[model samples]
Target: MKTKFNYLIILLACLFFMACNQESKQLKQSQLPQNIDWEYQMAYQRGIEAVNWSIPAVSMICMRDANFGLGGSYNTVYWLSAPPTASIEALTANNQTPYASIFLNTKEGPVVLDIPPASDRTAIFGSAVDIWQEPVADIGPAGEDKGKGGKYVFLPPEYGGKEIEGCINVHVNSYQVFVALRCIPLGGASYKEAAEYSKNINAYSATKISNPPEGEYIDMAGKHLPTLPKYDDSYFKYIKELIDTEPLQERDMVMGGMLASIGIVKDKPFQPSEKVKKALKKAITDGYDYLEYMFETPGFSFIKQWDDRQWMAIREPSNDGFVFDEGDYLLIDDRGSLFHWATFFPRYLGKATAYLNAMKDADGNFLKGEKQYKLTVPAEVPARDFWSVIVYSKKTKAWIYSDTGRVGLSSYDKENMKLNDDGSVDIYFSKTAPEGMESNWIPTNGEDFFLLFRFYGPQESYFDKSFELPDVQILK
Candidate 1:
């Protein structure tokens, strides 16, 4: 009876251990899929948000700092919001022509006018001015040429005192003008309150200018110009769905990893559930490995090889191979005289890589799949130097499809192209030559791809909504 009881006890203990092992396995498996899904969604969302936030944040910084914007030619415009007690007496003696309008609020009433010293005419006007050949215009005459010669209208304290709450409209052209509004509190107004009012006016002005959708620009090869993606209701809905479905712990882990990738957090102790911690480790490891692989990959090797000097050709003419790079079929020096300084050169290349990376399709293909496109370059595409269209493979970091034995299409090689009877050009993109169209073929390797439209010297058509490029469609 004693031996039989011992055997029963051992059997029960074995059964209990087996049951516990099964439960452990089940729990791990259940958590894994959810963790992975959450990781992917969270990482992608962070990347998208980073790009979105960068635009407004960079613009605001540029506006605040005179060291940036339009090659640093117009920093004084940002100083117009100074305190009321700040002396304009010194300003008047500087021989500075206050083309910008100033609004002042005093205890008695408001004042507004174009300030004095009227000899030096320099303000935030959009266009370039030929100040050498033509004499600077007076306030009355300058107002007429406001938008023409890039002469902006000034608002001064003599015209409107501290109580003013209105804008000065300076005509940029016959059809278009910008309004600079000033909102100031009455006399003995708190500086804090006045500052808040100024901020409100600035916000209002920004909203007005940002309206009116700027049409997308396309290249002759059918690639869209890099622009901010439209944020729509669908995008917000997608974000909401991701947040609701993903576990909070998993989301935090993913976000933390992404932040680490951008050097936001170098070393920090992070403790979460074992599963969440594992997922975070896997994501960081995988992302870095993939990027490393890409650097060594056939088409993407350029990213690893090209230095800042090589990329400078996209902005300035450096003897450091920018103008005479082997891959560049044509070089256009559209940079104006003001941009000749090296200190300001880096600004132009600021968003080039980020813009290229953002050109991806829904399927995670950067620029792959069969694509059909139509583009129109109107007669006399204006540029200071030249314009060219270049196609790049995100997978290869090189031009995907081209018979030119080059990466770019330039005006210098105009004679080499088979132009249509009407002086237009037609180019084809594919992995193989499409039947009879061998000469115009751009070679692809059946991977993701993108294209860049480099306008060495862009004219008004590039900025104005007049010239439009056709949309690209997936053929297959």
Candidate 2:
């Protein structure tokens, strides 16, 4: 009986030791740090929010800086003499039209933009935005002057200048403003003809309205202009410069406090400590990843224009002004997402044009660069002016460079491209051109890319959902 009791005691001791070991392992897995460093945590969180809020403004500054790098300054016009190519490193720039841009510094006084009336061969389509990238005036056929051209006077904040007769007055809250116009060819005119017509658009100070100085025009054809915002520590410096140069808006006071926490206060030098800098670096890089994640898994529903197709509107249809200003609050993530992949969003949406984006194929897979694909453009596209499809890198959001020197195939190329018996066209995308299909292929250069199908002067069928575009298919 004693021997049996000893064995029982030994078994009980072994069971207790095993139970203790399991409890210790669980405790180690759930261990907490001895203390929390709230400073780094707060800086990291606020820095992410600040980067999200500052992307649009930073993009504007980057464009202006790029122009300066190209030997052009404020009040100077830099226009592309042909369709944008890989040399033009802008975010989501179209390859079907020539672009004209100008940056005006209005700290001293107002700036006057003189737009010429639309001609039979060409017309301007674009908008002017403030330092905050808010549209102060849209100066194209559908803009302030309508089809007729006039002098647009952009008055600074709280300006007391007398209104000029027959002039469209735009009250702006910031001194730095940008004007970008697409010189579109009309009546099947060549892009070169549109480029020549763009020379008629000019800008001068309102002070010299009587005798305008000769405008400086810099043709940016074949020039390299890299204007994409960098996702790095230097981004904070641009924000600092912007704050120091422009007056703060009332709506941004709370955000300003957040900026202050990270050494971006107005009138104060931005020199963060090593600890803060480390936090900032982590915040911005990770924040960019987070933004990309949000794009992949969009919070907002994609507007499926066709029930059976996978093509979606490039942006949310209801987002007017690109500001995401809801009745009471702002849709911050939507605004950030739009600007992350594009620049030069206008004051209005889908009135003059419509853009559709296709990132996935019909079978619901992200576009693979190593694979081949095909898109079919039907005979009757619902566009009064024209339609185009351009491919951009999924990572850089810029043009894909290749030996062919082509980034898109559009309605403009239909005459040369092979068409089906029904008059529909098949455009291919891959690293190489298919046999006898060189004219209709856009090389992706082994990089994953997205498509922007634009319809200029969209017709009733487009808006009324009577027309539909087919989804891109794997070119097996």
Candidate 3:
């Protein structure tokens, strides 16, 4: 009878153990999504920066109270000089030559764009950028005009135009549009003259009044050109500000909902709870990992001619749309990935200096301005207009400021680069100019920098990989 009692007690213990196991599993299942929220937030954070990258570069103009607009507190038109410095407002990674720029708030009406005639060497282009910084229309060289400049009337979305129809008509995808003009002084035009002609690029209310006020120019020389906002916790603030000011498109509604779940909503205040912020911090880690992989993938890079070369280019467009049937088939992931990695302006192969920035030397090591290096351009370079090698700060993403006040050696510099016996050119980057190769030498000022190899009006050879540029070979 005692033995029978012992067996009953053992069975009861087994039952209790099984029940506890089941209860633990149920709890884990209930908490799974909450625990995985970190992964969700990372993807969410990247999307915010990728989509609204250009806002800070433009909005800072207003935030600075630049006193720019005609007869008002803000001046929409800002003129930048050739070879943009760190100080130029709204700076980009590959900002070469003089620039005439404006931010259009067409909530009022369509803004008319007027362009001066293009000289042979003056590579003037006006790009109409939406709030997303996507190119709505690129007017000027390599545009519909083929450098024969004309007046372009920019119409806002859902517009029934009430303005004159004599000029070329282009449409803006969003109401909050920013236009930037790049003019490289060519055919012997004076720098001052080129700067003044850029001012001719103007925008004013198209329908509000006949002959809307002419655009006033503010010299952007030596002024701090704002770069796009950083990708971080503060990135959310820029996203909120943009959504608040600009009209949101229908496709973005889904993302807007996701954002609101994290306390980011248009017209509503953003108030993220501590739990959300904690999840987001971890999400940021995962987000950067995802972005880092994109740089390695071939889809994001088009220059895949040589397997061993680290120099790759974002040579093609990632067709992005949220909905597949309506043709946003490629969508946000890859598009956002590229935008975060580089400062991009939408255009074709040969418009503004097409660039390939190298963070690594030829040996696949990080490029250090502390070390001396040599890059050999073998005989023939594939370019229609010109090609050059420029040094830039790896940290600032701006042109590295040097004692010479010169940034890079251009084929058009008239300084005359020394070519090899086989017609190849060797460009050197060092803290000081090499013995006799002063023109070919780009100073790093002992500062760690990267190289931006630009082929303005790139030729077929660049696409075909026939004219291969040698890697940055370490000299010392």
Say which candidate scores most in lDDT: 2
TM-score of each: 0.30, 0.90, 0.79
TM-score of 2: 0.90
lDDT of each: 0.32, 0.85, 0.63
Q: For model 1, what is the error of residue 156's alpha carbon versus the real structure, in angstroms, after optimal superposition?
A: 40
lDDT comparing candidate 3 with the true structure: 0.63
Give the residue spans of candidate 3 off by over 4 A: 1-75, 81-83, 89-96, 120-123, 160-164, 274-293, 296-298, 318-330, 351-353, 414-418, 432-436, 445-448
For model 3 the local lDDT of residue 432 reads 87
Query: Which candidate model has the greater TM-score, 2 or 3?
Result: 2
Pull out the clashing pairs in model 2. none
Name the candidate that leads on TM-score.
Answer: 2
For model 3, what is the error of residue 6's alpha carbon versus the real structure, in angstroms, after optimal superposition?
A: 25
Model 1 global lDDT (CA atoms, 0 to 1): 0.32
- RMSD each, Å: 21.2, 7.4, 5.3
